[model samples]
Target: MIATVVGVGLIGGSLAISLKEKGVANWIIGVDHSQENLAKAQELKIIDEGSTLEDALQRSQLIILAIPVDAMLKALPSILDKIQPHHVIMDVGSTKEKLLQLVAGHPKRGRFVAAHPMAGTEYSGPEAAVRNLFVQKTMVLCDVKNSDEDALELIESMVDKLNMRLVYMNAEEHDLHTAYVSHISHITSFALALTVLEKEKEQGRIFELASGGFESTVRLAKSSPDMWVPIFKHNRSNVLDVLDEHIHQLQQMRELLAQEDYDTFYKLIQKSNKIRKILK
Candidate 1:
């Protein structure tokens, strides 16, 4: 298959590499708003060539949009408008509810598959693209019932060939769950990074003592605002809901610490350790 990967950044470039290496695509065409990204992707051999979306769509059998949610919202309908019956379009946006709703009633809706590959890192650009990023990661397919059978099957087979795990959910469910599992983590990391930076001004050696735990906790803060702001905007309600619960937990812990309630604080830490069972 010839695949056109729109956005040509970390996710798109990485997927393009994997597709060719794993034999999912015979040729990959990269489409990006930034010509510099296209040039870099070509130099890295992440894409076979770079072209405008319109021209690439004409020759590609599969189209994968790995752009931010905001751009995906703007582009999906038009791409669907131009899609041929043989074309299958998939999106790897973080939040799904709004994007899925926008295209819900489109005449060519069946040609698109809503997907979020639960993978990435605190990086961006074509240079950050790495092969096998999706390997063993979860690929969530949202609202598959609305997609044409062949379209859904094509994405499923591609996910399998990439050695990813498959998950199914409706749009709303996907957004809500991801807000809890993914969005909240980034927001917390951003907040923690701010907290430390603010403190570092007063204590210049603050970061000198930073360790693995602190590094891992604040790593997502380095993620691109270009990508996450739109996610928080689109998944606002779900993110706010999770933030409320997260704040409540933080308050409970704070109250315990302030009152010197070591017993309850101990219990709170013990309770939080339950996450290790699930994660490990």
Candidate 2:
């Protein structure tokens, strides 16, 4: 099988490499608007060949759009014209609600499968991509009912090649769970960064605190703002709703601290500590 992957950034580059490694694609063609990325992808052997969108689309039977949500919306209409009924198209964008709505009425909507593989790193560009990025990850297939039989089968086959688990949900449920699990984690990370940076600046006496928990929680703060800003914007209502509840919980914790409530604080820590067992 020949596959064309657009927006050869981290996700696209990673996918191209994995497909080649798994022997899922006989020829993996990369398409990116950036000349630098194309050069890097070629140098790194992430793709068999790099070409313009038109050239790649015309030759390949499978298309993968790993671009940002906004860019995905802009590029999708042009995609519709080139995509054939037998060809399967998939995206690895973070948010799904808006993308689903935008393409819902397209006559060839079934040819496109909405996919979000819950895998990534705090890095970008073709150079940042690594093999096995999607290995054993949960790859969510949204609104599978809306995708064509061939498209769905092809998409699932690719996931199997990557050793990914297939999970299904509608776009609405995807957004809701993503907001609670994924989106809120970003907010927590950003707030933690702000908290640390502000403390390092204003509190000179607080420098002695060195802990693993702090390092672990703040690691995700290093993520790219370019990727996050749009996600927060597109999933604003859900993200903000979860964030409000999170802040409320923090404020409640602060009140307990102010009152010298050790019992309440211990219970609070124990309740949150249960997450370790839940995660395990």
Candidate 3:
């Protein structure tokens, strides 16, 4: 397959590498607004060539948009406007609802497939790309019924080549669930990192005493705001709902601690530990 990945950042670069390594794409043409990123991707052999969006679209059969959610909303319609019936367009953005709605009524809607690969690291750019990043990960296809059967099957086959598990969901359900599982975690991590930074200003010994648990909990805070801010913006209401409940839980724990209610706090901790059953 001739593939073109727009953005050439972490997700796009990683996809380019995996597709080449697994023989999924015979050639990869990269498209990015950043010249430096395009250069880096080419230097790393992540993409065979770099071209403008219009030129790349004309040359490729499979077109993947791995840009931020906001950019995807703007670019999807235009790309769909230009694609021929034989071209298949797919997006690997974090959120789905808005992008799906933006192109819902386009005449070429069936040529597009909405996908979210539930895999990534707290990193960005071409240098952060890695091979086999999608292996054993879940690829959620939202609103598949809106896509042509051949388009859907092409993506499913690509997902299978990447060794990922496939699941389906409507855009609304995917947005709500991801807000709870994915979005909230990043917000909590950012908050935790800020809290620790505030303490570090008063005491330089803060990070010196940090441990793995602290590192792991705050790791998502290192993620790029350029990528996450748009996500929070697009999924505003859902994120706000989750944040409210999170704050309430923290308030409950604080009140328990203030009152010296060790018994109830112990039960709360025990109850939270039940997450192991679901995660494991």
Candidate 4:
């Protein structure tokens, strides 16, 4: 089937590459507003052809929107006008609630499949595409019971090619869980990076003292502020709720240390260590 990927950045380019490499799509078309990205996507051989917004919808059986969260607010509405009954539209944006709300009453809503592939790297643009990106990932499909049978089948088939599991959730549930698991991780990474940079002040000292733990914790700080700013803004309530909890926990640790509550601090660390088994 012909697949058209919008934005053609890290997620879109990687998806196009995966589809082409796995023989998942009969043809892969790419659409990006940035000419530089379009060129990079083409140079990387991520798509079989470059497509227009209208052209991609008319010609493609599957369309993937892998753009920024804010851009999706405007883009998804336009898709409602162009999508055919046979076409399937899936967005890989981090947050879903607002965008889903925008299209909730659309005539072609059933043709659009809201999906979030639980995979990414702290990079952007077409050049950041990687062959191993989607392997062994969990792809959450939100409110898919409303999607057309054929449209849903196409998405399921493509996720299968990536060896990713398909998970079903509503828009609310997806955003809430992702806030706790995925979004919070990014915020923590950003804060940790800022904290270290503030403390070290010297870039040389930062590089000299950096270890595996620092690298692991600060990795997501490399993610684009352009992309994340809107995400945090749009999901403000949930993000702030989680951030408050995180800050409270941090304060509690500091208080324990100040009071010399060694036993309580040890128990807290032990409880946090339980995640090792769960994450493993």
- Model 4 Cα shift for residue 154 (angstroms): 1.3
lDDT of model 1 at position 15? 94
**Whole-model lDDT values for every prediction:** 0.94, 0.89, 0.94, 0.89
lDDT of 4 by residue, 1-280 (tens): 7899999988999999998888888798899998888987888888777868888777878889999999999988888787677778889988989988889888898888899999999999989999979999999999888787888888898899888988999989988888998889999999988988788778997788889988999999999998899889888889999999999999999999999999999999999999999794
In model 4, what is the error at residue 123, expressed in angstroms? 0.7
Error (Å) of candidate 3 at residue 4 is 0.3
Worst ten-residue run, lDDT, model 3? 199-208
lDDT of 3: 0.94
Provide the clash count, candidate 1. 0
Model 3 RMSD in Å is 0.9
lDDT of 2 by residue, 1-280 (tens): 8999997888999999999899899899988888888888989999888898888877899999988888888888779867777778899999999999998999999999999999988788988899999998999999999999888998899899899999999998999899987889988988888987886875544446747887678778888888889888888999989999999999999999999998999999999998898683
The residue-by-residue lDDT of candidate 3 on 1-280, one tens digit each, is 8999998998999999999988889999999999999999999999999999889888899999999999899899988989999999999998999998888899999999999999999999999999989999999999999999999999999999999999999999999999999999999999999998886685557557778998899999999999999999999999999999999999999999999999999999999999999993
Q: Please identify model 2 stretches exceeding 4 Å from their true place.
A: 202-211
Two-way lDDT contest, 3 vs 4, winner: 3
Clashing pairs in 4: none
Off by over 4 Å in 3: 202-204
Candidate order by decreasing TM-score: 3, 1, 4, 2
